[model samples]
Target: MPIVSTSTSAFYERARASMKDLRSQAETLQAQLGSGEKLTRASDDPVAAARLRTLSRLESLSSIDTTNADRANADLSLADSAISNMATTIIRAQELATQAASSTLTDQQRAGIGAELDQIHDDLISLANSRDSNGHALFGGESAGNAYSVDASGNAVYIGTNSTGDLPIGDGQTVARSITGPQIFSFTDASGNTTDVMATVKALSDALKGGSTDPAGAAADALESLKQGIDTLTTGQTVVGTRLAWLDVVSERRSTLTELRTTEEASLGGTDIASTVAQLQQTLTVLEASQASFTKLSGLSLFDNLR
Candidate 1:
């Protein structure tokens, strides 16, 4: 019968396994301390890991919304500045119209006034076709080119799209980034006919230049058209102001929500340093004791073999 040497070999294998298990536990604890994270892998806590993933996804979405909001606000600010300048120019034109309506002005004086009116018309068209910070047409909606261009008839025509290009500022929220050219420059007269500021100004200028039979009537018509232009601009400005207020509210709410997500993510994934430290110490103590016992047991086995 072969002499059984199973006891010593079996004890050695068991001792090695025990040491490996102890070391593994200690290493895991140390890693947690080093990383300041409780769950190094998804397997550590499946529910927590899943929640973390959801939070991460939401964070990414919020970031995108923030970017959109920022760009939209910038565009809106640019629009407001441009429109304010336009209002000022239109006011000046209105004053000129009032003065030209007087019969005391000579033909040469009217001609000079018409020349100035032409300049104002050109400036107004330039304002209508202005670009935003990103160089896209501010009043052109989604069009990349100039917002207003003259057609064959010499009247300024809207060459851009009607859409103001609404952008997603946050979940379930969209806003118009800018006002379209037509919204600011076009109007309907009391007679229910559509008219544009450019046409009104240009026609007035021509009447003065060509010495219309009724210079006073021509100037009066131009003044009425300018009055309508100012009203249209005022309404557009109000709409833009309202939109800007909405953006402010939405931006604040998003910031609060992002902060909440950050807190929740930390709660689910962050490590407990004090508890982990205690656990690591306990594991080390146990491992050291086991090592000592294994050393004594191995010495006894060797001694018995010699015997």
Candidate 2:
């Protein structure tokens, strides 16, 4: 026979490669067991990783939207409360004006009513300049500071902008978060009548203090003006109530959408714990068997047999 070659390196190399592969699998399984997860890195499953990333981004956006909705809701609630208070104040003023309009009332009685009306006017002005959670004027439109200011003659002057800022509620939608004082309290009547409530109060106060004996006619006119003002404020309150109800509806819808998004995210990226645990156990068994076989082969070389 031809000369027999005693080289068994191929067998040793193949055995070493098998051992290396087994060790790598065992290490991966150990990591999975420790972390209670199947994938240690994105490279392990790129498709799942990408889906998880998308879900995470969407969750972040949802959180931001929720915050915006909360702010918008707060603004609307403030507006509602303000309007309600203003309506009550207007009604009180109407009552006072009616009392002053009676011909039987003396100048002294009208003066008392005028003083009270002045106080109510001041209260209304304070409400118009009320601040929100952000310390910005609630009825100031887009202006952050005080909405109404007093002139040299003690007349109420509007210092705010004309446009109410809109707050985004997501899905390409936005809501007007506030109404300006001018929008609610200042207007000209259908009969070409121009008046501001504060101005009316000032005029009544001047007439009363002047001790005019002919106060009944002026007071009568003020009573009609007070009625018109009350009607205007009531309309504003109605608008605010409608806006609050609409916000509630949108909030509920957003909550439902958020729940759906959470479920979708879980389905796309969540791990299967039972399957991952079973795979880890199998890998451990294979690794142990491979190590035992490698040890036996390492101890038994052809040279040992010769000995």
Candidate 3:
């Protein structure tokens, strides 16, 4: 049989190595507990760290999308309110036209109605050029200035884009921020002629102010155009209302997606406090026992044992 002899230096080396390993493990567990994260560096779990980074980027983009959705909602709401006011003003103008169409009314009375109609035209123009939440033209279709500009002849002309730009809400979806002025104010009449609300009102006002050979005839002719213009406004309102409803749906979907992302983020990177605490306690206990045993064995010399 071969006899096995252990050297004191080798014994000490083995005992020290074992104690060092236990101490290292205890320190690592304590660090994990302090940081409240399972990973101290990307190298700890490369795939998980990469996934966390991707999620962080998506979260940042989602914040931006939320801001854009809010702006779109605000601008659309402003457009809706302005359109409502314009409809009311046009209806009032229609009432005045009805009074002007009466043959019983004298030219003087018609002139007074024309004066009110002039003010109504101006009010309509102002409403058409209403400002949005960001102070840009509300119905200008992305134009920074007024949607309708007054020429030297005092006629309102459209100087805005034909199409309103779309804003991205989220999930590959977009919404138009507003409807253009012409969309609400211009349409084809029964006579197959294209006319706008502002122009029709201006013509009647001019005619009633003695610019026409027959004031009552002009006022009668304008009734049909005014009715059609009101219809256009109503249609525009419906479009805006539909867009607003779509925004609501998109907002709800976004909220749901955000909740899902939050849950995934927690599952992927959040620390397990209960498990970590238990591991730390077990490591500490083992480290303490190994340390005490090492100290006792280190102090036990051959001569001491013999004595």
Candidate 4:
């Protein structure tokens, strides 16, 4: 009789412990539903939790890459706009040079054209030293100073460093944010003479100011130099356009990858509300049944049987 009673008591103790476990599990499910996240602790699903950690880190890095890519794209756009403005200014200078080339124009008219060219030269210099979003020179490269500055003799000098600027837009990927001052504004002429657009325009302006031996030849040379300058600017624009297109492609790729990561994260660590609620209901039902059975068994006392 003693042995039978001890066995019965052990069974009831196990039943009570199981009921407590069911209630704890139900509470965990409720918390999961409230938070909208499963695997709240690493112990919930160790392998899934590890994978989620990695994906979370990657998502963070991808966000930074997207921001950098956007910034680079904006900077490139600004550079392109500035280059277009420079081209327009050059076209106006060319027009003035065309009028000055004519033999019919008087000294007074030529001087007035030169004066305008002077202003244009100054304008080009200002444009070359244009600031970017951060107030640094757009074409400054790594240099903190202006991309181009006038020396004592008044010739514009390239003061910036090489390799404009490169930004890491993604994992193992980078893009140049700008072009250098010399790439767009300076080039060699048809006669193998080294000249920048500004220098050529300035030279033409000086020649037109003075009574040269042959203003016609000088004007022709200036015209050729101006054409070369336009070509240089056009080439630079093409390069910038290509980079902008590349940025677009890369941005799309990054965005798609981010979406994929989110989906994977959801599968690995997110909750299923319906499934969790059903599980909680089942656990509660079992807990209630165990409690009722335990109470009935506990009420059937040996002394009540004897009575």
- What are the per-residue Cα lDDT tens digits for candidate 2 across 1-307? 7997645687678778887887787777767667655567899889978877886787787777778778877987888888888878878887887788798887788888889988988998988898876889898988999999999988889999998888877777888887888778876754677777777777877776664566777777777677777777777777777877877888898889878876765555444567656776787788788778878877886677695
lDDT of 4 by residue, 1-307 (tens): 3453467768777987888898899999999899889987899889999999999999999989988898889889999999999999999999998998898988888889989999999999999998887788898886777998898877888899887778999879999988998889889988887779999988888888884777666887799899999999999999999999999999989989998999998888888888999998998888888889888887786788685
Which runs in model 2 stand beyond 4 Å of their true positions? 1-40, 211-213, 292-307
lDDT of 1 by residue, 26-120 (tens): 99999989998889999999999999999999999998999889999999999999999999999988998998999899888888889998999
Mark the regions of model 1 whose C-alpha exceeds 4 Å error after superposition: 1-18, 285-307
* Model 2 whole-model lDDT (C-alpha atoms): 0.78
Give lDDT: candidate 1, residue 93: 88
What lDDT does each candidate get?
0.90, 0.78, 0.89, 0.88
Candidate 4 local distance difference test against the native: 0.88
Give one digit per residue, the lDDT tens place, for model 3 in 1-307: 9999998889889988987887787777778778766777889889988988898888888898889889889999999999999999999999999999999999999999999999999999999999988899989998999999999988999999999989888778888988999999999988788889999999999999999998999999999899999999999999999999988888898888889888777667766778878887888888788888878887887887584
lDDT of 1 at 64: 92
| Candidate 2 lDDT trough over 10 residues, lowest sum | 264-273
**Greater-TM-score candidate between 2 and 3:** 3
Highest TM-score against the true fold, candidate: 4
Give TM-scores for every candidate, taking all chains together and pairing residue i with residue i: 0.85, 0.81, 0.87, 0.91
Worst 10 residues of 3 by lDDT: 263-272
